[model samples]
Target: MRFTTIGAAIVDIVVARVRPVLGAKQDVDHIGLYAGGGAVNAALNMAALGGEVSIHACVGRDLEGGLIRDLLQRHHVRADIPDHTLPTGKSVVMVDESGAARAYAQRGASAWVGEQGFQGLDQADVVYVTGLSLKSQAWLEQALSSMETPTFRLVVTPGARQLSHPQALEGLWKRADLLCVNASEAARLCDESVPDADAVSVEAAESLARKLVRRPGQHVLVTLGAAGAVFFDGAQECFHAARPVTAVSTIGAGDAFASTFVHAWALGDSAQNALARATDSAAGIVQVIPANRAGLLRKL
Candidate 1:
């Protein structure tokens, strides 16, 4: 199946287990640069899994953009990305000893992508959109208003920041056939006070899922990290526990799950089977630091 993903294409400078003092430089156990961003990561995952994938996120005509393009080509993923005058987007990701990651980002060229970027939407069987793409009003209209209903399978994976402002993407989610989010993002979308994945009880998470289902047949999937994920479709609901693994980094785990799930489901896997596939894929990603396309391919 052909998949098109639209959102940010960023350069991630990942640092592992480094604690810094205000004015001094510190040594790190590991530091590497990789191509990243929700859309970029998801597209690469689908490509590695043998799907024909194309990405439409904006990049700049700079070293960072060149890096992103080269990585995409090496992975066999098609790049439909356009170059911008601004620098390419970037993020500095810091991973602690516990394998948790935090990021400081500059949206850069990604922030400038608008309606013109949606020109080739009809070329794919499935169109996957990340939260980063919906921030522009013109792009949002092109995606939701200008397009026909149910032209292709629409899968949405809104990040925590987008979920924080649910009102902005309300219409888009309502129109989506599949909506994917982690426990924290789900809680935020539902206006619930879920502090973390563990704190989100299955019942509470299921309740949040029900609230997120905008239509009768729409699927709302809430992933709870190692707890796995919960799926609700207004009628049926199921919880799948994650396979156990020692995590190297939790970064991009959610993106792995979303793309894997979409790939499996599009290939005719049952919802339960798709959830299992996603959980297993995410488990592998967590075991690799950076969890970008090359790392995932290496793990494979």
Candidate 2:
């Protein structure tokens, strides 16, 4: 299927084996730079899974921008990056020995894409909007208006960005063909009876999915890391349990799961097959570095 991922593209700086502290220093195991961003990772994941994907985002006219373009091009994802004077957005990620990571982000060019960036958003079979890109209500409106005809499936994953302004994205719950959120985001969107964000269980997933607008071509998929994922439409719910694995880096697991599920579903796989594809794809990604799915999820 033709897939278009809309949002940010960032250069990620990762330092290994460092215990983050305010005033103290720790030994670093390793350091590296990689291409990342919600849009960047999701688009690359689709391309890796054999989907015709394109990325519509913004980047700076700097060295990191060149790296972003090259990385996207290498994976055969058409890169539609708007040029900006600001340095490309970047994230400084610190990882410990146990594979957990903390990141500090600079929006830079990513937050400046604005409405003009939505031009390349059309002509795709599936359009996925990174909720992290909701810096402009106008951009979201442009995206919503594009769905007036319903020619393509609109998938929204409105991470923490939506949580901060739940009212602004209320329209998305109605328009998005599929809504994918982690357990915490779901818990915040529900009424008082829902499970707590800390307790990300099937009950929480189900509760959050039920609160979503019931419309044609609607679905809610909630990812719970090792707890697996839950899929709920209006009628029933399906849960997929995760397989255990030692994680190398948890960075791109969600992107892998989201894109793989969309790819498999677009290929006419049954829901069970799609869920399995997503779960296995996520499991495989955490066992390696470099979130590119070519070596990680392609052969799966």
* Backbone clash count, each prediction separately: 0, 0
The TM-scores of all predictions, comma-separated, are 0.93, 0.90
Cα lDDT, all candidates: 0.81, 0.76
TM-score for candidate 1, please give it. Answer: 0.93
Instruction: Give per-residue lDDT, candidate 1, residue 21.
Output: 58
Output the number of the TM-score-best candidate: 1
After superposition on all CA atoms, how large is the RMSD of candidate 2? Answer: 3.8
Tens-digit lDDT track of model 2 for 39-136: 88889888878889987788999988988888788789998788898899988877777776778999898886554646555588888877455665
Residue-level lDDT tens digits of model 1 in 1-300: 999887888888888886655656878788888888888989989998889998878889998898788889888888878889989998999998788899999988887666364776777888888857445534755665766654678888876556767887787788788898878888777787767886687887898898888887798888887778898867988888889988888998999998999999889888899999999889888888885657421111
Q: How many angstroms is residue 267 displaced in model 2 relative to the true structure, after the best TM-score fit?
A: 2.2
Off by over 4 Å in 1: 19-23, 295-300
